[model samples]
Target: MYGLVDREALLAKVRAQMHDKRYRHTLGVAESARRLAERFGADPDKAELAGYLHDYCKCWPVEKMRDILVRHDMPRELLEGEKELWHAFAGAIVIQTELGVSDPEILQAVRYHTTGRPGMSLLEKVVCVADYIEPNRDFPGVEMIRALAEQDLDEALACALGGTIQHLIEKRKTVYPLTLLAYNDLVSRRDAQGGV
Candidate 1:
């Protein structure tokens, strides 16, 4: 559906939209997403595209993001919740309405990059895990997650989600419902598969 989307131009736009550090991270995510998609037998090109635009609205002002969120009629809870989550929600709308991206997979990949939902697609899983394990990212368990990502997408995502939840709990931060739902769904799937 998005055959007319210009990948290079979109990349350039994304690069221009972000600061140097964030742009570097975006590049790292795109490369990581491409590699993960290749490993998982998904479309590397689409993964790269999604990764590049996933944080398109990260640099936008809070006021502008709030406006976009209202314009799109996003979940009232999201609008009333953490300001940090606005980027992912607003980025998806901006990607479609402003950037002219029409593909559902790409949009979903951007939309759920922050608070992932249950039953994510391969592309969504690839983007989420790639964002967590991007080369520039250096967290406590990043290496382990990166290794897990190289081996198993589902396991990598489950670990990332679990880690995020644990960190939030440790810091006494709000746990978005979707994040908990995604973690539970991954755990359930793993249980069903008799894998750990």
Candidate 2:
């Protein structure tokens, strides 16, 4: 149960901080998160909050994000990796230090929104999957993920994670180890339960 977080003010801050296209994506993620929460029986309000704030630092200058990474002592390996990954890790720190969000669940959701970790909480899975399937994410296999999400959250997330890994491999891009760990955990869980 999260306390009051001033949704209106948070939305305005997100609107001001992000560009129009990013803001629209954030809104879509929020709506998708809410829907996923409802389907999975998570707290929709909290999921929406996490979605709205997930990209809080997406538009920040590279220098500022790098500074946050330095301040937070992010691994040098990650620092040398994709610039896009900075937003999730740095956004988690920024929301706590700047936006005064102290809720651990919300913080964890923001922290792991990009490279999901093993043993994710329900809320975390909801945010990650919602982000992947948010409307406007026009990638191959998105519709299958959307349909799978409706039927089973874990299976949908495993599929989404697998898709991400495949995409990264095809592009010869860096693959975050934590994502692999998460995918392995999800796949194991689904298999243990006889697949979802």
Candidate 3:
């Protein structure tokens, strides 16, 4: 079990950080993460906690996120890359310094939830996929990914990440390297297991 956590306090802090719409999304992700973790053998509490805190800095000014990334010496690629990805990296640090979250798994979950990396833990995958299939999310292909998640987490994530990559391509947006690597890792592992 995780350490004794102040759930109400944490929720209050998280709610104060985002707008109404995003707060609803965060709640959805927390519920979805809890469900996914129950099905996928992750710690449901950790997954839900990660869900609530994942977007802690999502509504912050890009300059503020970039400042934290710089002062914390986050990877140069992250600092230089898309601002959309900044919240995940910056949120992990803020939760620790500001919210007193010290668990490595929760921190990593928040860090990689936006742009997944290779060799992700089960909790990480749960939080990441939950972000996609949360009830508040209405993106195309989400239902298919949700169905896939019930059967296989890797395949579900592969489908979701592939969709993300293709969408980026269609919009002429740059796909982060770690996203590609995470997709490849899931696909390769599935192939090795004789799955498509």
Candidate 4:
């Protein structure tokens, strides 16, 4: 039953803690979230709030993130390997416990914004896709994904997941198994329905 936190206060805290680059990314995400919310018929305020706070815990030290997860008794399987990616779940906890946000939709949106999962809610998909295809994102082929986002969310998600998987492979980084599963799930769902 918690209500949305004060947006300005939340942004202030994030700005105080994050470096300029990270803060810019936050702003980009907020804009992207608002845009996607409009496109998908979601609440723009909630989308902006969720997107702005999606990375609240991203700036925390790795040890602090680990401690938060450990104290919450987060499943070890989810915590194992890819310690860098633990911030998303930890951020979910922070959003609920610290920010007084109780909405499952918003929490899930923040939780999966990084790695994403199957059967994501509309809000979740918006935040996830926004984070990936935000206008300020200048990675290779981002324009293509942005176009897909404008036209078809599912296709955009598929492309983003494929790109992420490929990038991880190229960097020799450990690809989270959930990411691959999410990609396949989206692809399968899209194909089964004749596209989304």
> Top model by TM-score, which number?
3
Per-candidate Cα lDDT values, in order, are: 0.91, 0.91, 0.93, 0.86
Using TM-score as the yardstick, the better of models 1 and 4 is 1
lDDT of 4 at 20: 88
The TM-score obtained by model 1 is 0.95
Please, what is the TM-score per model?
0.95, 0.95, 0.96, 0.93
Q: Candidate 2 lDDT, tens digit per residue, 105-182? A: 989999898889999999999999999999979999999999999999988888999999999999999988889999
lDDT of 4 by residue, 65-148 (tens): 999999999877777868767889999999799878898889988888888788877888888899998777899989999999
Runs with alpha carbons beyond 4 Å of true place in candidate 2: 1-5
Question: Residue 77 of model 3: what lDDT?
Answer: 84
Total clashing pairs for each candidate = 0, 0, 0, 0
Return the candidate ranking by TM-score, descending. Answer: 3, 1, 2, 4
- List candidate 4 stretches off by more than 4 Å: 1-5
Q: Predicted candidate 2: what Cα RMSD to the true structure?
A: 1.8
Tens-digit lDDT track of model 1 for 57-158: 999899999999998888888988788889998999988998788899999999999889999999999999999999999999999899999899999999
Clashes of 3: 0
Better of 2 and 4 by lDDT: 2
Instruction: List pairs with backbone clashes in candidate 1.
Output: none
Q: Give lDDT: candidate 1, residue 11.
A: 68
The TM-score between candidate 4 and the true structure equals 0.93
